[model samples]
Target chain A: MADPFLLAATALVALALGLGLARFLRGPRALDRVVAFDGLTIVSVAAIALAGLVTGRAIYLDVALVYALLSFLGVIVAARYLEGGEQ
Target chain B: MSGVLDILGGLLMVGGAAFLALGGLGLWRMPDTYTRIQAGTKATTLGTLLTLAGIGMIEPGWALKLALIVLFLMFTNPLSSQVMARAAHRAGVPLTPQSRGDALADDEGRAAE
Candidate 1:
């Protein structure tokens, strides 16, 4: 239960999540929130992958893959909506 | 051989996490949306890739799927960031005062004509 790698990775990711959340909450613009959200999602993908590694299961990687795809699509949609939602 | 792989995987994962943290910090501290996008996207992309690579190294068997995820991220992260930046620009988001020029603004004007 005391895996150094897992512990280190988790701590670093937690730091990232905290910072990203701070940006998201402190956003001065709508698009700023969007950008922070994107970063936060990517960081989560890494965290999921680390979880997969820790558990010794490959399934979590698949979940990470799907999450990444959804994140990309979501960001694209959000950006388009911000661009006056044309077309 | 096993020991070497374990060490390498741990190193890669740790390094990746460090990059992720840096990306987050940049997102927090960057003055403008454009700069935040640059910092957030580029660093996170590398960080995610490295973390995935480390996972693949440690497990070996999951290499193929991890590679697929890596390839997908390579294409999407930057594309999404570019989309966001373009949208922000079109939405009339202004650059910081210190920013010298807006090349896209010139092109946008031409396009509007």
Candidate 2:
């Protein structure tokens, strides 16, 4: 496939995922894992968009765009639960 | 002609990727939750933005897509960081031993008083 874009994007994604795994494994606390998850979301967005570029399909871009918002919202909702949980 | 643009765009995107890697390393290396968040937030934000912009440069059709992604990120990234920080504080995560006053702690203390 003549899609260096996708290849490069995937490499970056893998790197981010690797980092996420590291965070999950060695994280000092729950919040560290959560922070890594946030990073994963961002990487996923970039990866999906790059995939679209590789495939010559504009659809993936939209997915990336939508996912970014959804993941962000998800993080906020999770945060609220976390913050109020002690109460 | 367009080759130079491609090279620049590729460099920008790849450089961003490297920054992302560095940020991730920082996340793993940093000893505390707050510091990890800071590392992840600063580097990943800039890296992702650069990657998105690079894609936009190479693929004109991706302009709107990149723009939309960038827009949502601008709004959400900081807010998410705030949310995570607040959660970390509420969960009673121990701050680094050498920390100064924590505003959230002060506020909560006053609220309880």
Candidate 3:
């Protein structure tokens, strides 16, 4: 059976994701949006990991890892571009 | 014993999720860009790490991989946020009125000579 706590945790993470999206949409500046985007990605990682735990699947952990790496790279690249580091 | 472990894992997951929610709220409520980044990065990093560790506790065999994920996040999250903050500063995002000073700005001024 899936753990009840894991289910609750997933719901919490989803709520956090919604809040991040709200900030992203309400941004007063580009960087504010980027910060919100970063928060969204981190919460998504937590959500995915919690899902893997609830489902009893090891493979989903791999997916979470890859997603984390890709998100980190994307944030860094976007930051660099914002800093005028070239296209 | 298994039940005990399950309870522990559940507690950790709940705590982690609470922190994640706190980070999101900070992002919504903070006064300025740098403050929001600070709130988001610090809280989410701890939240994600706790969540991964909780998952590892639930599945002993997956502990190693989960630990690796946590380590990667510990390293990357702060670095990425720092980069973002610097970029925001350079892009001329203004600080809130309560901000004390810009040490980086002073450094840049000294370097320009």
Candidate 4:
């Protein structure tokens, strides 16, 4: 049987993703958008892990791990560009 | 015993999702870039960790790999947030008007001498 609690949780996370997207589009400064982008990634990771739980699949967990790693790198690169840390 | 575990895992998942949503709210409502980063990093790290732990409880065989993901997240999330905050500050992103102080500015002034 599908767990109702997990289903609700996933729905809530999807709502959070929408909110993050709003901030990303409307943020006044570039860094504000970057922060919103980072928040969206973290929420997406949570959603992926929960999907693994709901579907009885371990492979999704691996996908979550790799996605998290890539998101971290993306944020760092964006931050470096904002800071003008490299030419 | 199995039923008990299922219930516990479900609870953790719900709680994690709640925190994740709270972080999103903070991101949308916070006054400045630094505050938004603070909210996003702290809430989402705990939220993801709880979700991973819930999954581990549900599927015991996947626990080892799930633990590794949790560990990596704990290390990277805050580090990335810190980098973003520092970069924003250096890039001259303005703080909220009510902000009381700028310690980084003081540090830069000291360094200039």
Please tell me which predicted candidate would have the highest lDDT against the true structure. 1
In candidate 2, the residue pairs with backbone N, CA or C atoms under 3 Å apart (3 or more residues apart, or in different chains) clash, namely none
Poorest lDDT segment (10 consecutive residues) of candidate 4 chain A = A78-87
Query: Candidate 2: where is the Cα deviation over 4 Å?
Result: A1-9, A85-87, B106-113
Q: Model 1 chain B, poorest ten-residue lDDT window?
A: B104-113
- Candidate 4 lDDT at B51 equals 77
Local error of candidate 1 at residue A79 (angstroms) = 0.6
Measured against the true two-chain complex, the DockQ scores of the candidates, in the order shown, are 0.66, 0.54, 0.67, 0.66
Q: Write the per-residue lDDT of candidate 2 for residues B34-88, one digit (tens) a residue.
A: 8888887657888888887877777766788688788888888888998898788
Chain B only: TM-score of model 4: 0.91
lDDT tens digits, residues B1-113, model 1?
A: 58788878888988999999999999998989999999987799899888888877888999999899889988888899999998988888888887888888886674321
TM-score for chain B in model 1: 0.91
Runs of candidate 1 exceeding 4 Å displacement: A85-87, B109-113
TM-score of chain B of each: 0.91, 0.87, 0.90, 0.91
User: For each candidate, what is the lDDT?
Assistant: 0.88, 0.75, 0.85, 0.84
Docking class of 4: medium
- TM-score: model 4, chain A: 0.88
- For residues A8-87, write the lDDT of model 2, one tens digit per residue: 65687678768867886776566677787787787777777667767778888878877887888887877777675443
What's the residue-level lDDT of A72 in candidate 2? 83
Query: Model 4, range A1-87, lDDT digits (tens) per residue?
Result: 327877878887998899899999998788888889999998898888888877888899889999989999999998989885322
